[model samples]
Target: MHADQRKKLINELTALIKGGNAHVTLSEALSGIPADMRTTIPDNLPYSIWQLLEHIRIAQKDIVDFSISKDYKTLVWPDDYWPQPTDSVTDEQWADSIEEIERDQQRFFALLSDEGKDLFSPLAWGTGQNIVREAMLIADHNSYHIAEIIVARRLLGIWK
Candidate 1:
């Protein structure tokens, strides 16, 4: 990786992470959770808080894998990657998925540091995309879905 390029990517991801942290702390993302409420889908969707976490985790993991792996095919997930009953997850399970996602982010960043710019040539997502772009997309994607998860958790009365 180009040191300067890598630094730039790190800075971007760091900013995203910091922003997400602030949003989670200050926003109404998970503030809808009402005490004594049980799981109920606002829509007919099968996704729950846990499922969203898994979805985010899997997507991030795939991007991280793609960042370092020679083969992009191996980084993609099949249709069944999302957990069933997505909204019925226990608090502990949701927490576990969140932790895993964070760990995956760290692993991905470390891999980028190890691989440098050489590992960042464009492959699938963009015909000629670099790892920096890939990492930014990954970070941005995670922030987006995590916000949704927080909101969903609040809707399910589990965010508190």
Candidate 2:
């Protein structure tokens, strides 16, 4: 990657990460609502705001791992893994977990810089990919969850 191209990639990734982080932080505040207010659901689904946070963190971790590894074949999904429901968890648990998630996201974004353009290189994911494509996907994934978080907060009456 040339100097200019690398800079562009870094800028794009940084913007995406920063925007997502802000949304996560905003959502975290609302996740601290009283337990009684959390009982309502939009579609009888049990996906609490906390569960969505965990899900997004999992995907963010995947992108960070992919950015650092060289071999495109390195990506692999673990067996017996399932998205955990966090509705039963306490507010304290949600607060603590989201703090850690924010920390990890900051570290991952730090990898986006002039020298970090290698992350944009074509990677083999049982198909093929470059960093730009991966970043875009990750960004979109984050945005999707952001919308969900917003909706969940609204449904729970904690959007304030």
Candidate 3:
């Protein structure tokens, strides 16, 4: 693709990944959640706010690592992606999760911003996977969970 087209594509992908265009941003959705409520699992929901936050951070980190690492190893489903309900997070840990999520997103953004990288070209190490597909996956996955976090907060009567 031409430079103009590539730059536009990068901009759009960055917006999508940064979120808040169509739905609440992950950070916004996560903000102002009561500290005590982070561990509370609303009725019928399988995860707490803390679990959702950690899960998003972990998955994003994995995707970013996979995108950049030639030796990326596949993560175990449900196991590697989701945090255990039994697990508890401290206030510091919660903040750390959010920080890592943001860091990982910036990492992916840098990759997308790199003109040397071929957005459409499949990685030689993977089976027909390209940056565009991975980027969409990141945005799509994060948005879905962000919505889930909002729903959890709403269900808990914590959303304002």
Candidate 4:
């Protein structure tokens, strides 16, 4: 791709992954959720808002770490990717989780913004996976969970 085209692609991906798109961004979805509702498990739902938030944070961290790490090992699915669901999550824990998510997201954005990097080139340490693929994965995964949080909020009557 041309240099200008590459730059446009990066900008678009950044917006979609972070915020300012049609889908609800993580920041928007998490906004105004009361502390009590974070751990409240609505009927028929397998996970609470807190669990979902922590899971997203954990998965995003793993993906970003895998992209940059020279020696990356796949995490054990389901168990490793999700936090233990409980009603004991405190406000501090929620804040910490959000901070972790934002920090890793910034790191991922830096990776996307680096002009020296090739989005299409496969990581030498990994099997055929490229930065672009990982970015899309992060965006898709985050969007899905953010929507889940929104749904949970709506069901709980916390979101208007």
Highest-TM-score candidate? 3
Predictions in order: lDDT: 0.61, 0.62, 0.90, 0.88
Poorest 10 consecutive residues by lDDT, candidate 1: 26-35
Q: Give the TM-score of each candidate.
A: 0.66, 0.69, 0.96, 0.94
The prediction achieving the highest lDDT against the true structure is: 3
Scanning candidate 3 in windows of ten residues, the lowest lDDT window is 82-91
What RMSD, rounded to one decimal, does every model reach?
4.6, 4.1, 1.1, 1.2
How far residue 99's Cα lies from its native spot in candidate 4, in Å, is: 1.0
Candidate 3 lDDT over residue span 54-144, tens digit each: 8889888888998998989889998988887754568898888898998899999999988899998998888898999999999999999
* Candidate 2, 1-160: lDDT as tens digits: 6788777767877677556454664445454666654434456555666566666777666666665565523434542112554336666766676676676567666655536346655655424766667667767777777777778777766676
* Error at 87, model 4, angstroms: 1.6
Residues 44-103 of candidate 4 have per-residue lDDT tens digits of: 888899999999999999999988877788899989998777867787888899999999
C-alpha lDDT (0 to 100) for residue 102 of candidate 1: 72
Q: What is the TM-score ranking, best to worst?
A: 3, 4, 2, 1
Candidate 3 residue pairs in clash (backbone atoms < 3 Å): none
Model 3 misplaced regions, further than 4 Å: none
- What C-alpha root-mean-square deviation, in Å, does candidate 1 show against the real structure? 4.6
